[model samples]
Target: MTRPLPYFEVSQRLSIKEKVGQLFMPAAFINDSEEEVLRLEKLISEHHIGSICFFHSRASAATNFEGKKEVIHNKNSFGRLKELIKRYRAAAKYPLLIAIDAEWGLAMRIENTPQYPYAITLGAMQNQAELVFEVGKQIGLDCRKAGIHWNLSPVVDINLNPENPVIGYRSFGDDKKQVIEYARAYIEGMYSMDVLNSIKHFPGHGDTAVDSHLGLPTIEKSEPELLQNELYPFTELMKKNIDSVMVGHLAVPALSHGKAESASVSKAIITDFLREKLGWSGLIISDALNMHAVSKKFDRKGTVECAAFEAGNDVLCFADHVEEGIRNILEKGKTAQIEKSFERLWKLKERALSSELVDGHLQQDEELMQNLAKESLSLLKGTFSELEEFRNNGFEYLQIGKQNGLFSELLSNRTNNGPNTLLGIFPKQVKPKDNFGLTDTELQLIGQTLKEKNTVLYLFGNPFVLNLIDWQQAKTVVVAYQDFRSFQENAANHFMGKIEAKGKLPVTLKS
Candidate 1:
């Protein structure tokens, strides 16, 4: 019996076209039509495509900012994903590197999987590295069970700008040290589960106001400033030997030597800065090439893909036109670059495909959620006794924005005509534009209620939403970081003094 050749030796034997084919990691939609699934399989067989990044559907993709297409939710998405993976794996010549954007959990992409708290919520907890590790481990387990090799998650961007349209709720917080510590814990957990993870949106997408999905976001900060704050977390985590680092689409003029090219397609940023300056030799993956930031800039079919390859990305993720991209790479005599990336990618595949799927830890996941909610629910204003007093006095309940059923369940018994008011402010949107999706009517109602009655406020969305209204009037103010059922239940418990609010606000709030 003969043993198979190593990935490097395998790369040496591959033809130039096959090597180029091994660089493209195109998007695979579980909710796609039969034709689409067959198309991907053809790419796998004939094209020898390297890897696949799964999304819920094309319409549900992050680049679908126009909302022109209707996204019908597929309840069977989880099973469909698993079956699709099996089918695709059978079609591939080499083991495919499966990846997903399951930052919070499989629930990030799939409909009915275990969902965990966002990073901002976890950032609110004090001294909870172990808990964060558990969240990562559980998410890794979900990814493995769903036949995913890589979890494109744990966004390490230090969110310094409050009005950042894309990365507000996704980021851990503004502090770099905290982001590094939590990211290290999460990465360690993923390693423990033998699941690959990527710390993403490199150099930092946190302080920019523009949404890269819709348009180009330029980071105008100096190189030193970026190195000090934005690049700090990635720098620290790189030292600990992370699996991969995802290059974002944003432009940094300082790093690009005053040119405003997207970092995802800039050799200066990916190779010079990340690889050489930072001494990072791990696999470098590009954030989706379908994003408007780089997508709209290139008019030709595979111009961006070739540029990304030349820029030093080992894997071209979500490349729009795979065949065109492969042809262009072969045409441009990029055999050396392709072979380099192909070898690195196969090394990743070796580690990724070796892991066995772990079983569900539903009870442990739930307990972790409960513990996180309890520890992260912050008391921004007034005492617990004040809320108790309001409850005792038969407080009138008024929900200002979007309603949460679980939270409203606990407030069902409160009277409408009571002297004290319990105000639940659920902002319709997470982004900071248009007053965090609050209407004038809602603002008016919040002000009138707080001014007229002794109000106890419960804010169940972005903490930045507190800046939109005059919340000081409320006697008791509790910041429940998310509207998840666990948070809602825990906030209700804290309202009744069943649990204490132990969390400090993760992000600073303006009055």
Candidate 2:
């Protein structure tokens, strides 16, 4: 066996075509057909493409919001994913750095895999950074088992705006310090597995109302306020030697010096602020280049890739135009910059590939997830004893939206004819837009039920959804941040006084 050359030596020996290809991290899909896989494989072999970011399928990618295609569910997605990764890795000229949006776990991208709680759920846990770190380590182990090198996760963006369509449930919470703390735990956990992780949506994407996937979202906050709030976590995390910082396609006029360009492509934001002012020397990865916020202007002509590279990004994630991007960067005579980025990328790639694949933490992970679920349940509006008394007094339990089978089974002994009602509301969607996907009828039913009866409301979704309706009339309220089985079972237990609800609301809700 021969020892491989270091990343510096390997990067220095790359051809011009290979150098340009090393900058692109295009999207890969597990559900891709043989033909589709062939197309991507051709790109990998012919174009010298260096990396891939896996999504479940074309329909599930962020660009599929308009329902242009049907989502075909593949039960063997995990098996298919491993095969696809092995194929792509073999196709590449160099060792490919496989990545995914596995913020919560492989479940974020794959169907039949383990899932940890969302960042917001983890954020709500009181003094549970160790649990958050464990979740990250478990997610890393899952990634490694599936042949993934990088997890584009631990979204450090502070969820300052409840109306933020894209990053609401994805973010930790509004408090900057708490967000930094939890993000550190997540990154540290990934580090423990020797797995590469990126602290993302740089400069922050949390406070904006618009979804950057559909259109551009502008942040009007002054630079100082951004530093104090949105940029605080990034600053703190950067200090801890983060592997990479994924810049989002957000328009920060303050950072852009009043220019309208997004943070991902703005040299003022990425180079001037992040690179120079903050003195960050780690790899800078761009958010998906296909997003409407940045791509709409460039028309996928590789202009987005060129601009992103020029702005300071080392990796152009989900770049739609690989050949065009390669040509564009070469045409601009950015050979030196390209080599710098390629060398930087190779360093991380070396670290990513050196790690051993770790597996079989399923049982321990389930226990950790259960502990996180129970710890993260918040008593937002009512006393624990009051809710326990309500459950003991034979209250009529009525579910508003999607039924939790586990919760329903646990509370099967409750009667429907009781004077007090236990209204368990499962919001139709996690995002706050479209009233958290609550239908007019659902809202009307909630209003009518609340006014008509002494109802104890238990919300199992984004806490922001509570602001959409008049939840004030409910006798008592409890917020179980996610609709996972653990949360449902824990909520049922809390209602029965089997457990104590100790979580504080991570974000402040409007009264």
Instruction: Judging by TM-score against the true structure, name the best candidate.
Output: 2
Could you tell me the lDDT of residue 350 within candidate 1? Answer: 76
Top-lDDT structure, candidate number: 2
Q: Worst lDDT window (10 residues) for model 1?
A: 355-364
> Model 2, 1-511: lDDT tens per residue?
1122587678668897788898899999998889999999999998888789999889978877667788879988888988898898889877788899999889888887887878888888988889888988888778878888799988999988877889988988888888988999888888888788899898899888898998989999898998998998988888875899999998999998899789999999998999899999999999999998888888658888899888989999999999998888888847788888888888887777775665543333668868998899998777766776776667777787776567778887776567888888998778776788888898899889999988888889888888877888887888998888888999988888888888888887775
Off by over 4 Å in 2: 1-4, 359-364
TM-score for each model: 0.95, 0.97
Each prediction's Cα RMSD? Answer: 2.3, 1.7
In angstroms, how far off is 444's CA in candidate 1? Answer: 2.8
**How much lDDT does each candidate structure score?**
0.85, 0.85
- Clash totals, every prediction: 0, 0
